[model samples]
Target: VSGVRDKMNMLGAVTDDGERFIALTPNQFNAEVAKHFLRAVQHEFGERLVIILDNASYFIAKTLKKQAAADGLLLEYLPSHSPELNPLESCWRQLRDGRANRLFLTLDDVNEYLSTALPALNSPQIYEYLC
Candidate 1:
């Protein structure tokens, strides 16, 4: 990943209703970025949302939890080692497949690739039943 220093990192979520939202950022992924992305998700979906999360440390950060709680959003954690239970897991796989062994010359090149790849991923068939 360091090979592409200017490459973007995405923080994304997929709803049970099959809507996808993404935020592009640089390398660092911490509490602040997670909280900010959560807020964006909340704003787009509404504060009554319940977000399902994996046990990533930043996703479970105290401040992020507090903010979500205060905002009337529920944070639900999946059991550890349960990537199969996360709908985003499949989407991530396809995303990785799209970029497999490719080298982008610049951040713009990456974004251009994403511009096409993401919309192709928008179909409902990409998600699995998480129950």
Candidate 2:
């Protein structure tokens, strides 16, 4: 649940490999958002890789297809209403329900909290859960 409020954009990425990263950007749901997620994929798995994504308008199947074509990636789509199949969904739930919800304040405050939470989530123990 990446969201923009008060000109601040909060975006999070959690890979099946359990390498989670989040960013604070001024542009919400823009090319930078897509690029950030794609960059994480490349960093973890290189250029040629397959990634499953939920059906979000910003990261829609068509948009992913176009981005994949441009980047030479293989983006896969999971069925709607089946978020359990996406490991990132669990990560998002953790962040939103467990972390983000508990510490909701100004946008800047949320971004600050996310900064600390994201890197901490990229541990081997957390990665195992994704597997």
lDDT of each: 0.84, 0.63
RMSD of 1: 2.6
Candidate 2: regions farther than 4 A off: 1-12, 30-32, 61-64, 100-105, 122-131
Clashing pairs in 2: none
Against the true structure, candidate 1 reaches a TM-score of 0.88
Q: What's the TM-score of every candidate structure? A: 0.88, 0.65
- Clash pairs for candidate 1: none
Give the alpha carbon lDDT tens digit for every residue of 1-131 in model 1.
Answer: 65536758888888767789988888588999999999999998876988888888989999999988998989999999888877777778888999999998888989999999988884344345553
RMSD of each: 2.6, 5.1
Candidate with maximal TM-score: 1
Candidate 2's error at 97, in angstroms?
3.8
